[model samples]
Structures are given as structure tokens and as C-alpha cells.
Target chain A: MKTIKGIKISSGVVSGPIFNFERGKLTVPKHFIREADFDSELERFNTAIRKSKDELTQVRDLVHNHLDEDHAKIIEAQLLAVQDEEMITAVRELMVREKKNVTWAYFEVMDDYEKLLLKTFSQFFKERTADLKDIKKRVIYHLSHEKDIIQPEIIKPSIIVAEKMSPSDLMHIDHKLTLGIITRYGGVDSHAGILARAFRVPYISNINRIQEIVSYSEIILDADNETILLDITDDIKASYESRIQDFRRHRDNIISDKVANSTKDGVPYHIYLNAGFVDEVKAMDPALIQGIGLFRTEFLCIERNSIPDENVQFQAYKAVLEKMNDLPVVFRVYDFGRDKLLAMLDLEILQEDHVFDEWGGIGFLLDNPEILKAQLRAILRASAYGNTRIMLPLVMFVEEVVRTKEILETIKSELKREGLAFAENIELGAMIETSSVLEELDELAKYVDFFSIGTNDLALYLLGSGRMTDLTKNYYHPKMFRAIDKIIKAGNKAGIPVDVCGEMASDPYALIGLTAIGIRFISVSSSALAAISDEVSKIDVQQCGKLVNSILNADSAFTIYSHLKKFYHEQLE
Target chain B: MVRKEIKILNKYGLHTRPATALVTLVSKFKSDVFLEYNGVKVNAKSILGLLVLAVEPGANLIVEANGVDEQEAVDNLDRLAQQKFNLE
Candidate 1:
């Protein structure tokens, strides 16, 4: 069997038929229309237009009912294109004058319009070409009496093989039959990728020409290893199938125990799960962990055409809180900016000197106070149902914390005046991500109830490396560890609890270091919770503390990493 | 015919959604509407037509409408542009 490597977004193993689901380019077959069939041909074109409009209306209504108004607007936009008198008249003239088939005429009109739009609009507006193309394909499919190939009905469980899947396409995919998804182009942060993770579907992207390579083959997708094995032998397939079964069995056992949160040396610490979508929260068993540490609220805004109202926000937060059964849930305010632009909000992004620089966390929130206030009001309203806390991301200054508190006070008073029932003392915290925040940790900690150190950004910011782009493994240097140590120490001095809610906290090696540094609470992805808990139960906290202290003294990142590796195998492992 | 010149003011300029809003508004009136930018004119009631104008923030466009509801259409579109297409 040949193996293809791809960038894995979600982890799982499965074997299924490769459903070659490509959006095949529409080809317009030319035919000379006879004089007698002219009137009938024109009538046929009108019928096709009517059918196309009906299909779009149904799709729009379905999207509106199933998803949200914003998603429905995508189809609505296409409907408007269908109703464009200019486009209709152009197609009608082309068909009647050139004696061309309806499909050919429609395609020619759309092609000419696309060229004109390309010439008229700037490069920034060039992306709209895809939307225009989508409209063309939909109408042409109706004219040709062909089914829309994008939304195929899968009769059995199968792996979806495609060039790319849009967010709208991902929303419409039948989860039962879609065993896994492999695409030729996409990033882990793409909407389809995010949706795949949220749905717990095995997905990988950026495999070059995956659609052409494997044609109707029974493929084994080992997403955990980022490999897709084509045409496996029966013996190999049996082994792989058993391996998947073993993994599920192991996972079930780990999740079933409901183990207490304490190290072997009896050092009790809190393990919290990071969740974004409500579906991910529902998939999780609350009995397994303390509570949700980082509830990424941005997912609620991602697919919508308008800002989610306070009541909608309230329902989402309330559902999570009620599901947790009073477990303290920390709702992070919408951390917009960078690649996470809310097209609906149209909030002005603060210009950075470099295009790559991000405008995330509290900075984006503070710039749009109306959004911030709405989210605060929603979180506060939800807090009435269960235990909840508010956390601000990317806080680098003391003034940010002070200003946020001032706004929180204003919201609280407004709620009180309205006679709304909300938790009066919803604990507010700041995320210590930037080096600037680390430097002023003590001063900043005094204004907040707790500190959650987002080590992903902290490490990247400390080393001046892009978190995703920098291929060098040395980004997580001993210098970064020193920063973490200083922040934890400062939190202690200020008498505020410090927890880590980043990728570093999830790593077994980093968890040892964090525990040694006296970090009592750690948050990790929900999928990593059980595995990390197992590691935590094996460690002797006192010994880890000593080992970390020595590792921190190392001259370089390589030296520190090596020491930790040796320590893990010899003592912890 | 009623005509008015207005400047786009939203941060994102007259992008797809804002253009859709403008077209949807103009389509409600019986007046035939047209928008002119950089000496290129397009039917204002067509979303694709408006999108081709590629109006950036601070760009000026002359909107003209003719028919029974010409005045209403021009006044409404002018107000919408002033409000930044209600994008905020």
C-alpha cells in the first residue's frame, strides 16, 4: 500500500471507501438550435431559471432553519444574482441571437460578466469571483438537468475526498456517512477544519492532488499519524482495524474511571477542559474534569452575518453552564483579529506595521466596546444559572485590566438597574500571554481575580517566532520557561492563583515543569484531558519541582529540553 | 429624475453584503436606479452591478433614479450611504 502524507487537523483512524467528491467543472456542450425549436428552447431556459430559483429558495430556507441567518444569506446572495435583470437579459439575448443552447448561453453571459467584474473591481474584491462562479454552476446544473454534485447522498459510511470543502459545505455534510475528510488545500484554522474538529471527524488537508491519486479505493486513514494508506492488504487492514478498536477501548477505559485530580505524591491540582463549540461541550462528560477553562466564544460569531444578540449569547453560555452542573466555566470574551475577522461586525482592525502581526485578545474587544458590553451582559446573565467566570485574553498592560474592570462595573450596574438576576461576583481574570504582560504580572494581578497564562502566544511572543510558521523546534526555549516561572512567582506574590490554558500545559513534559513551578491548575483540549490526567497521576510533584528548578538553570532551550526528556524517562516515565 | 452624489463611509467600503443591502433597498422602489463611479455607470438594483463599482471607503458615487418613485429611491439610498449602510 502506498502512503500519502498530509497535514492532519483531527485525530482518529478509520477505513472507508474513498468517495471522490470533487466539484467537477461545468462543461457546456454546444448545439445549433433549429428555427422550429427556438421558442421551445427559450421556454426551456425560463423553466430552468424558475427551477434554479426554487432550489435556491429551498436551500436558503434549510440553511436558515438549520444554521443561522448569516449562512442563509450566502444562498440569498446567489438568489439575488439569479434575479439580476442584467444577467437574465444578457443570457436571453445570447441564446436568441447566437442560436446557442441555453446552458451555453448562460455560461457565456456569466463568463463575460465575471471578466467585466474582474476588470472593474480591485484585487481585494477578487475573492467574490468564487461566489459568482457558485451561482453560475447552480444555474447551469439546473439547465443541464443534473444533480448538484457538491451535496451528494452517501448511502454508506465513506471517506470524503475533495479538492476543498467550504464552511457552508461542511455544515451540510451528513455526519453519519462522512467517516473522514481529506482535501487538497486547507489549513488547520480554516472553517472546515474547525468544524471537523468540533464534529470529532477525522480530517486532513493540503495533500496535493489527493482527488486524482486515489480513485474509488478502499483507503485506511490513520489521521493520528497523518497518513492515508491506499489499497491495503487484508492482513494489514485487519491489524489496522484492531488497532482502532484498541484505541477506542483504551479511551473508553480512561474516560470511565472518573479519577480524582491529584499527583502520586498527593499534590492536588485542577484539570480543566478547553472547549469552543457547544457540540464539543455536549460530547464531553463533565464528570471527567473540573470545568471548562477556556470557552472560545468566537465560534458563535464565525458563521453569522450579524453580531449574535445578547439573548442568543445567553442561551449558548447558559446551556454550557447548565450541562456542567455548576462547575466553574470560564468564558473568554470574543478574541477577534488576526485571521479571526468577523465579516459581519465589520469592526476596523487596528493597523499593525506588519501584515502578519495579530490584533487579537482584549485589544480588539476594547476597541469595540459595544461588542464587549454585549458579551459581558450575556455572560453575566448566564452566570445566574451556574458557576461562571470571565477571562480577558492578550492583556499586556495594567490599564487594560483597569479599563475592563471599569466596563464590567458599568455592565453590572446596568444589569442591577434593569432588575436582572445575575451572579454579583463573577470572577474576572486576565490571560498573561505577551512578555509585556509577564513583565507587569504583579501590578496586573492586583486588578483581577486570577491569571490564566496562555503559553502558546507567550512562547511565540517571547522568542519572536510565528507560532504556526516557525519550523524551528527551539521556539520553546528555557528563556520562555523562565518567563513562565517569573509570572507564576509574581501571581504568588500578588496572592492570585495562576493557571496555564495553552498547548504547553497539555504536554506531559511541560506539565511536569508547570507542576514543579507550583502551577495548581492546568487547562487542555477536551480530547487531551484523559491522557494528561493519566500523566499527572504518575508524577511525584515534589521531585518534579526539583527537576524543573534544575532544568530552568540550563543555559539554552536545547539543554533544558534534553534535561526534561531524560528526567521524564528516568523518573516520571 | 432625481440624482444625488454620496461618499461610502464604512470601514470595509461597499463590499458584498453592503452592496447587497443597497441593491435590496433600491429594488423595493419602482424607480430605475443607476450608480456612477469613476465615469462607469451600473444598474443600482443589481447586486453584481453595484459590486463591480468596487467602491472603497471615502469614494464618491453619483446615484440617479427615474420613475414614479424616483425621489423616494434617491433619498433613501443617500440616507443609507450616510449611515454607512448601517454596518456599524
Candidate 2:
């Protein structure tokens, strides 16, 4: 029994077979099973193949209906591969002869054929390779999950051990069956780590030899102690079992028990969640949040190769709003440009050189008015169900909002003409992220319903252009706080509420600073709620106001940092 | 028994569409059909087997069949080849 210690990301104790998920790649687990398990393993392999066939047929039919017959033929070929008897026999023989698990045997067989088809993984064979690889991953996905896509539970759940899990990989995994996650080289601050933490998965990182540790049959993870126990004895398992119960009970209390959305003195505030994907939207407890402050719409389209049509986008928006009920849900229009580009959209890379050349978020969307129309149409249609607001991303000009309002007016008129019910007075808001927008905050706020400060981008634009700076390290600068302070005052003057819906909203010291500046609505990932609420409960609004008043006007970062440290130690600690 | 030599004339040769077409056509006839090229022979009824051969355009394959309707299968396949495996 070897025990390895690593940094604990989320606290829990879980015991399960470890699945080695390489970053952005699906790797097949090559593990042996008992000979007595051969029949069941083969059964599992057959079931996976059946599921793959069913999935392919549905997709093929969908293509045939919506697209041309040529696209359907590609899926038909995959269906042929699934039904091929020789591949099935080879898989069964390999599993029965070597007593291997179903996924192991199946992956080996398909991989051998894929290698045969394309000797080198090159551009010329990309389509064929992609087709074959799609079939492979589909079967494996079916084997891992007990039911269809987006369902919570999985059959043979495994703890994911990765070198580094990316955000896309985080989306691929179903949280309910993922017992825990341990990466060889990820910090708790990494994007994937934060996501996993938000999803309430037990996670740890910075362990050596991901390859070495993943070879074990099963693992007992004691994240509370940052210890992984392999080859556990009966006595150790017994002790850990009780420990697991205690840990889950403690954790459940933290999740289910609501914290007051106020300061220590009962000053009222609202806590909202920022959700990107369907699972997060579906899993939200409306009682715990005021609404989803920033429904990242681009996140929905980024994962797919094709642009989602009005119906797809409408369904997604409808799910979120229905879940939120009457709470105001802000669905940000597709924030695509610069780093985020759609594959199917006829768009060139929006380079930094084009920062001011009609390539801003609202500019790009206005240029591609079709994408904007589809999103607006969807959000407006969904508005009939619940309280919905449309927020534009990276707005630098009031004219952009004015033009969007014009487009919305046309869409609303069209929807009304078509007999589609929608909220006629749906509010429109703009994200105050761009530096240019900060200067025109009062004017921009006038054209919009409200403002949600995207501090991540605001800081990047504010501190990014300054001397001797890495955009990553320069966050929540005093200059940024001053900028946010300005945005809040302008928003207050304009009689529109301002929101902080960025990483700064969740960070302890930054949250205190934002609260001090009299920002009331804070939106963060659900994982940050407990900690933020705990900090909120520690001090009154008066203390936060004092803390900010003392140093927010200071010229030096050092002075602000020292003051914040002193304030935290004096009050929070 | 019926045997004939045919050349792959489709744009992608014996790739997915042509391969699937070949398998579907051969599987329908009551015959044991086989395609031999470069000393490698595979069951004509299996798409994977036909694709593994990777018979390129203008490549010749000796198609052999032996069953009650062997002649009909070979005749229909020859007609398909003449039309470039119904490339569309």
C-alpha cells in the first residue's frame, strides 16, 4: 500500500477506481479484470456498441432531416463500423482471452484499425480520423455513463486523475459519477480546478507521476489530509468509511444550509450565480441565488463546431429562466470575438491590432447581425417565461447599445407579428469591461438598463497597458478599484444598479473592497458562495466602508496592500 | 463461380461511401463475395474489410463470387463500377 500526498483542492474523502483523463484528450484505461468478469465485460462492450449505434442513427437522421443527405452518409459509415461483426468478435476475443475490461478491449481494437487507416496523424486524413475517433469516444462515453447525455448518474463511476484538466474537459465530465479529481500538475487557482471546486467535486493537484499513480486498481482519497491511500487494508477502509460519512455530513450542511445575504448588521445585499453551461443552470437552487447574473452565452456555442440555431439557443435560455423563476436572469448575448471564435461562422481572427477597428464585442455581433438576431430572438422569446435581461458584452460605445436596441425593436416587432409571446419591456444591459466604456459610463448606463462590471477584462485593459506588467499578475489593482468605484458612482447617478460578476467579486479582499464602494449585487461561481458569505458575515458594511475609505484613494499599490492586510488581520482574522 | 477484374473509378476510390456501397451491394446477393488486390483478399460484405484494402482510384481488384446468384452479384457490381461506384 503506497500513500501519496498532494495539495487538497476541495475537501472530501472518496474511494473509487481512478480514471486517467489526459488534458483535452480521452485516453482508454487499460486494466485487467477477473476471468469470471469476462461475460459481464463483453455484455458491457455489446451494450456500448448498441448505444453508439442508437446515437449514430439519431444523429444521421437529424442530419438527413436538417442537412443534406451527404452529411448523413458520413454518419451512416460510422454506423457500419459499429455494426461490423469482425470488430465485435475481436473485442470479445481480446476481453475473454486476456480478462480485460470492456473499454480496454474495445479501445485497443478500434485504435488498431484507426492506426491502420491513417499511418500518420496528418491534415489530409483529418476528416476520416475525426470520424473514427468520434465513434471511439462515443462508445467510451456510453460505457462510462449509464444513461443518455446530460443525465446525472454514471454506471461505473471513476475518480478522474489527470495531468491537467482543461475547462473543455471539465464540461465533458459528468459531476455526479465523478467521485473525485486529482491532477498531477494543477493549482487550486487553475481554471479547471476552480470549475471542479464549483461543481463540488473532491479535487487535489500537484502530485508527481500521473502515469505511475493511475495504474492502481482503486484509490482511497482523504482530501482533508491531502493523502491518497492505495491498497488499503480492511482496518484502514473501516476508519475511512466513518470519516467519509462525517465529511459528507459536514459538507452537506455547508451546501444545503443557506447563509444570510447580508452583512453582520443585516444590511441587505443579493448574491447571484454565474452559469455557463446547462448542467450548472439545471443544478442551481433558486432559493440560494437572486438570479444568474451572467449567463455566459458564448460558452454554449464555443464547445460545438456549428453555430446553434434559434431553437437550440432558445431552449437553453428557456431552461435557465424557468429554473430561476421570477428572479432576474441576465443572458449575455454571444460574446464571441478576439479569443472566442466560432468554427462555422465566417469570421477571421479578431487580432489585437483590430482593437479599435470595428472589432469590439458589440461591433462584431452587429456586423454579424444574424448571430445577434438568433440570440436576441431566443432570449426575447424566453423572456415570456420568467424575468430575463439581455446584456451585451464588451460594449465601448453608446451607439452600439442604441443599434442593439434598434435590432431588438425589429426583433420584438417580428416576434409580435409572428404571434410569439415575449416580454415587451425586457431590460437591456451592457458589460462595463472595456477601458473606453469606463470613461463613458454615465452615457452608456443611460442607454442600458444596468451594468455588470467584468473586472477580469476591466483589469486586463486597465492594468494591461501599463509599464512592466503581465496581465495575469496585474488584477484588482488600486487603479481598477478606482475605475470600479467610478463605474458604481456613475451607475448610481443614472439610477441603474451595478453588479460585480468577475473573479474579483469572489476574492475575499476584493469583495470587501467592492462592498466598501457600495456595490450591492455580487455574482460569483456557486463554489465561492460559502466562503464569500462567511466573510460577509464577519464584518459590517461600516467596517468595509472604513477599510476602503482609508486606502482606496491611496496612490501606491503597496499602501493599499498594507492597509488591506492590516484590515483583514484586524477585523476578519 | 463468377470472377471479374474491376477498377475503382470514384473520386475517393474505396473510401467510406464507395466502401459502404460495395458492402451493401455484395451483402444483398446470396453469394460469398471477395475482393483481392495486392495479394490481400477480404470479404466483400464487410465495409471495414473493403476500407482496409484502401483500393485507390484506377486500382484493379479481382472480384470473385460463388453462390446461387453469383453472376447477378458480379454483373450488378460491374455496372456500379462502370458508373464510378455511383459517386454522388
Candidate 3:
């Protein structure tokens, strides 16, 4: 067995056949067209053009249906480019004049076309070079009959092995058979890695000889271990197979175990799921989860141009509430801005005097009373269906909560006047993310119902870093844990329930810190549930608290970091 | 034949979405539509044509149309462009 070391972008252990997609263009074979067969040759070229159009349309529709219109817009423009009168004429003219094979003619013309586009002064036109190159590949693939030898039929679930890839290629990944993606070159924060995470697949990169390893029948991709085992013996295969089985068994055992929400010593956790849509709740056994800690209402605003009116937003929240039924679902209202965009809003992300008070969440909402009221009315209106809570994102002070409550009251009066039935009470909660919010939680908790530690943003603000710039390195900073400990302890003192969510909830060692701090609840992405459950089962809560105490009291960031790393190795290993 | 001139007034130039909107509007009519910007004329029905023009904000674009629906095409295209493709 040959073991290759690589940088793991996201973690999981998967074993599958390697589907090699070459980064460089596949060889476009050339042929001399005979005068006698000119009609047939031209017909074949036309067939390729037609097929390429169909493929672009198919991809466009797929992205439109699955993702959002924003993602679909680029493909929509490409679909128009596919039938551009000038581009089609250039391809046919090349074939007619050169007596060259359709694939070669198409390739030569498109290659030149891409260069022509890249040379253009307009950024809009220059950006089309990538699409032009992609279009060239699609057409050439249909023209060339060599499939099995080059790009095979991706029938089974396989790990994508590539030397390098573009974002468009990553977007075209057939997620049905998507086990994972590994490449010879890419940053963990590359667009491909981001898409891989969006596609819910493990991704790794930085390996050598990606092109040479295509002949292997099957390989094991243990991203968690940062190892890709190749040319595996039967024994190695069977052992990895059992490891997969063991993972599945543990997942099933914990999911089935009613008390999986508790530590081995019977300390209960309000284990919740962080969800974006209704389907995440529908996919799970409802009894296995406590509730959704964070349900982004931004999904309604994301697709299409206009802001969803009160009723449209109301219906979306109602679906989740009815689906979850008895369980409490915290709906974060229109956390739109900073990556979550509403084009109509025309948001200029102006910096407030406070660094953490960047545009989004309560800050953005409070500025637009109409938008805020519409969302407050919807969440409160939906509350009649089931248990619901309203949580504001990026809440730094108690006053924002006060304003939202005032608006909710005003909205409630409007609903009552309009004869709209809303529940008597819908809980108001705050996401403890901003650094300022941390200091104000004691004063803040009095105004809200419960608290959720949004560690992703909390860490970002605390460390004063952007997420794209190596958050994984900064995320482990010792200051992050102390902050969580502070949030949890403050929650305990204030007599309000605090739940940990975002990245820290799933990170094993950070989870250790969280559990040790006597946090009563935490929400994690559903995929990590089984592994997290297993990690909790192994931790002796009593000892973890003692370990965390020393780490917390440490004078230096380096001192605390070393202690946390040591704990991770000793316990999680 | 019919002709009209419109200014691209959107904060962002005729980028992806607005270019798409312009192409979609011109395509609905049976007329042959063309847009002239920066001394370059291009097929109004083709998104690539609009993109290559690189119609920046405040640029005056002359549109021409010929065929059965010429007048209607010219009017709608001019209106859409003036409306900034109804986008920000």
C-alpha cells in the first residue's frame, strides 16, 4: 500500500474509485477531411454544436433549480454566448477553409477566440475567456469519441482526482456520486474547497503526481488523517472497509440511543442542528435532535431580486415550524449583508464606529424599519403554528434588542388590528458573536430569551480577522476558548440558557472546552453529529472541566494553545 | 427601420445581469436589433455583443432595429436601457 500525504481541507474518511479529470485539455485529435465526406463531417460538427448547447442549457437549468439565480446568471450568459452569431461563423469558417477535423478546427478557433477575449480592455469581456475555454472543452468532448480512455462515464460514486481545476469545473461536480475531491494543487480556502463544502463532500489537496495515479482501481481517502492510500492490498481495503463500517455503526448506535444527547456520566446537552432550510429537519429522526439553534431566514431573501413580503416570509417560516412541530426553532431574521446579499437593497457595507458593527443582522435591519417589521411580523405570525424564537445576528448592544422588541410590539399591534392570529409569546434571543456583545451579555441577557454562541463570527471579531484569511489557524487561538467560557459562565450567572453553535461546536477540542465550561446546549451541522456524539462519550466531563480550568488561567496565548493541543492529542487521539 | 439612443446609467456598467436583461429584452422581437457604443456596433440579441461593448455608466448607446417589429424593438430596448435594466 502506498500512502500519500496531502493537506486536508475538510475532514471525513471515504473510500472510492478515483475519477481522474485532467486539468489540462484532453488531446483533441486532428483529421484531414476528404472532399467526398465533407457533408458528413460538417454534419458531425453541427451535431457537436447542438449537443454543446444542450449541455449548457442542462447545466444552466440544473444550477437554476438547485442553487440560486445568482449562481445561474453566469451560465445564463454562457448559454447566450454558445449561440453568438459571430462565434458560430468563426468555427464553421475555420472547418470549411482549413479542411481540418471539426474538433481541431473548433479548438483552434476557440483557443484564438479566448485569447482575443482575454486581450480585451473590458473586465466584462475579459472574464468571458474562462467561459469561452469551458465552451471549447464541451464542444470538443462531443466531437471526440474517446471517452473511456480519457474522461470515463462517472457512473459510480468516486473521489475526483485532478492536477488542478477551475471554479466552473468544481460547480459541475455530479454531487450524486460525489464522495470527495482531491487535487495536487489548491489552497484549502480555494473556490473549489468552498464549493466542495457546499456540495457536502470531503476535499483535500497538495499531493504530487495526480496525473500518474489515475490507473489505480480504488483508493482510500481518509481526509481526517490527511492520507490517501493507493495501490492497496486486500487486507488494507478490508480494514478501511471495517473502519467505514465502524463509523456507520457508531453513528447508528448514537442516533438510536435516546441519551446520546448526554455525556457518558449523564450530563445532558440540548443537542441541536444548525439548518438553512426545512429539508434538514425533515431528513432527520426528529427525536434524535433537540431543535434548530439557527434557522437563517436569509434563504428567502437570497433567491430572486425582490424582498419577500410579510406573507412569503411567513410561509417559509411556517414550513419549518410545522415540520419541526413541537421542537423550538430559532429564526434569525434577514441576516442579509456581508456575503448574504439582497441586490435590491444596494448595500454599501459602511463601517460603524464599532469594528464589529459591520453591515448585517440587527444593524442592517434596524436601519430599514419596513424590512425589519416585515420579518418580525412573519416570525411572530408563524409562531402560532409551533414553538419559535427570534434571534438577531451581530447584536452588540442591549439597545438593538430593545428596538427589535419595540418593533415586534408595534408589529403585534398591527397584526391584531388586521385580525392576524399570532402566538401570545415568541421568544427573543441574541447570537453572542460580536466582541462588544460579550461584554454586554449580562445586561443583554435581561432583554432577550436565550443566547447562542456564534463562534464563527465571535472568533472572527475577537481575533480581528476575515474568514477567508486562514481562520483555521486563528480559530484555534487560546483567546477563543476563554471567550466561550466567559459567554457560558455569563449565561449561567444571568440564569439564561446559552447554546454553542457555529464552527466551535463541531471542533472536537473546542467542544471539549465547551462541555467543560458547563454549557447546557450546543448545535452543530448534522453531518458531524455521530462523530461529535462519539467524542462526547469518550470525554470524562469531570476531568475536562479541571483541564479547561488550567488552560483558562494561563497567562499567555501560547501557553493556553499548547495545553489545548496536548488535550486534543491525549483525548481525541 | 427605427433608431434610438439611450444612456447606461446603472452604478455597475452593463455587467452580467444587466447585459442578460438587455439581451433578453431585444430577443423577444422578430426584428434584427443592433447596439452602437464606443463606435462599435453589435447584435443586441447576443449577450456577448453587449458585454464586448463594455457599456460603462453614463455612456450613450445608439440602438438600431430593422425588420417587422423594428419600431417596437427600438422603443423597448431604449426603455430597458434607460431603466438601468431595472437593477441596481
Q: For residues A410-485, what per-residue lDDT tens digits would candidate 3 score against the true structure? A: 8889889999888887888889888888888789978887888887778778887654344655545668878887
Give the alpha carbon lDDT tens digit for every residue of A1-573 in model 1. 788898877677888887777552455667878677778777777887786676566556644643456556656777788878887888778877988877788888888777767885477567667667767755665566542332456668889888877554564457768888998866654556656755667887778968555674688888889998886899889889887786556434435656458888898888888887786787667776688899988777643323467888999999999999988899999876554543222112111213445567898778768778999999998999999999999897899889988998998899899999899888999998887777787778779999998876776677765533322344347876788788888888888888998767766666777777688899877556777888888888778778765767878877766767777798866
Worst lDDT run of 10 residues, candidate 3 chain A, spans A344-353
**DockQ of each candidate's interface versus the true one?**
0.38, 0.26, 0.33
Q: What is the per-residue lDDT of model 1 for residues B1-88, given as tens digits with 9 covering 90 to 100?
A: 8889988998767877778788889999998999999898999988877776788888999999999999999999999999888766
Error of 1 at A197 (Å): 4.6
lDDT for B10 in candidate 1 is: 81
Model 3 residue B54 CA deviation (Å) reads 8.2
User: If the candidates were sorted by their TM-score against the true structure, best first, what order would they fall in?
Assistant: 1, 2, 3
Best by lDDT: 1
Q: Write the per-residue lDDT of candidate 2 for residues A99-218, one digit (tens) a residue.
A: 778887887888887777776333333336666666766677667654334222235778888766655467666766788888876554444555666676788777886777788878
For all the models shown, what interface RMSD does each have?
1.6, 2.6, 2.4
Judged by whole-model lDDT over C-alpha atoms, candidate 2 comes out at 0.74
The TM-score obtained by model 3 is 0.65
Better of 2 and 3 by lDDT: 2
Model 1 gets an lDDT of 0.75
Which ranges in model 1 have alpha carbons more than 4 Å from their true place? Answer: A20-127, A132-155, A162-174, A185-199, A213-216, A248-254, A303-306, A342-356, A470-475, B1-30, B34-44, B49-65, B68-88
